[model samples]
Target: MATMITDECINCGACEPECPNTAIYQGGVEYDGLDGAKHAALSNDFFYIVPEKCTECVGFFDHEACAAVCPVDCCVPDPNIPESEEVLMTRARQLHPEQAFPEDYPSRFKAGAAAPAASAAPAAAAAPAAPVAAAPAGGATFVQSPLDALADTVPALESWDVPLTCFRCRGEFEVPFQFIKPGTVLHCPHCAGSFVPNTILYRDVAKRVTKFYDSFTAGLDAIRSRHQAEIERFEDQLRQSLQKLKDDVKEASADAALAGAPQKNRGFFG
Candidate 1:
């Protein structure tokens, strides 16, 4: 289980920079994974998270880093998905174990295990599914939406929770967004736009962006490789031509020398 962002996010660009795992991203941007294998497109409607890379601050902070600084208190615990403190710590260690921890740093969970269940009060399970894949190095780049007053985008999260839906295609999907701010547009993976009123259509936008991003990147690589190969071939041809010219000049010089060689006189005409 991991943390999620709700639709209340104001797109202030505050939480985007504070994320530790670089899991947070702007709605429309794409991120490359640390594995150097895949890329993920972000939604344009609201701030998003990458679940695969989110350790929920288990390894580093006693509490969540993003939640600490979010002015709106939107970075609350995700109720739907829950994990023990131990599990969160393990996840954190796995994400960034290279850092050194203080000798007396306290762990929130049981000794070498996940935190105990909180008296069986219907524990939270897992974090919402992220929209994009993890990147190779610095992960995703979050682009905060320009602030403009629009109709409130958030719902009464304290009451009924809303599900992520494709605005255009009417498809039900999973995209982790918290209700931190307003006027934050959620991006559609297929339709190439944000879902106004949060519907199924925007999923199409998201999908299309992903496809285009991948194809465009692949095409760029292909073109670059072809150009390099062509340049190399041309250089090789030029070298060969230069060598041929040199050989021809040498041959002509040799021929001239032979032709100019004075005929040997029968006797010794000095």
Candidate 2:
């Protein structure tokens, strides 16, 4: 059976990107399938899942990714959409042909049991166990080696104190560099404006600085794309307002020109 989002969803939007099939959609958003088919919003107030596209991650993972990451645990199996493992696997194959699934891939109907290890050879079994380097028979205390002690002295990553400025209220704050990560959203305490901190790298620890920056920028881009429709609407409204202002100005200028024109001599005198 395909997974469904329940009414208890808080619309946190954490499950949308985790789906391998892109079956999840935000509230009131139209969904477009890979086959160029469009579907209307299932829910106008809560996040909804497209049952047709949901395969419950049968061929991809042992468990459904949406349910795994949902903070509210609202992504549950749909009782109305009762589909067998075979049907789900077939759909998964159809959706992602490039990824191949084994015949016994873990599914609702299949038990995900590990295959038994092969038996050891008789000759190998007959071989004696290797001798062990034993500690002194006495209750000897173990002492740390020089290299082991040196390993403990390795320096930790130094954290940089970065200053955060609120975009709305212009309030200043300080946060540890480690607190600034990819996709981390912050809110201003004063203005309550949402802000996503930039990825800061004081030192190249684990060579992940560049990767973190790229991921952070990508998340910001995704956020921008998600609200692009709303942005375009605002832009359209601005354009209309500008046009109306221009029209009003033109009418006022025409009225002034007429009012300022000298009237001809009275017709009665002529």
Q: Worst ten-residue run, lDDT, model 1?
A: 147-156
1-270: candidate 2 lDDT, tens digit per residue: 678887656666868988888999999999987669787898899889888898887777777887765544567777788888789888989888898778777654556633211112111112221122235457788675443343334222224345678878999876555666666777777788887754443333213433333333333334445467677999999999999999999998876747559876788868
CA RMSD of all predictions: 19.9, 25.5
- Top of the candidates by TM-score: 2
The residue pairs found clashing in candidate 2 are: none
What global local distance difference test value does model 1 have? Answer: 0.54
Model 2 worst lDDT window (10 residues): 116-125
User: Per-candidate TM vs. native?
Assistant: 0.37, 0.41
TM-score of 1: 0.37
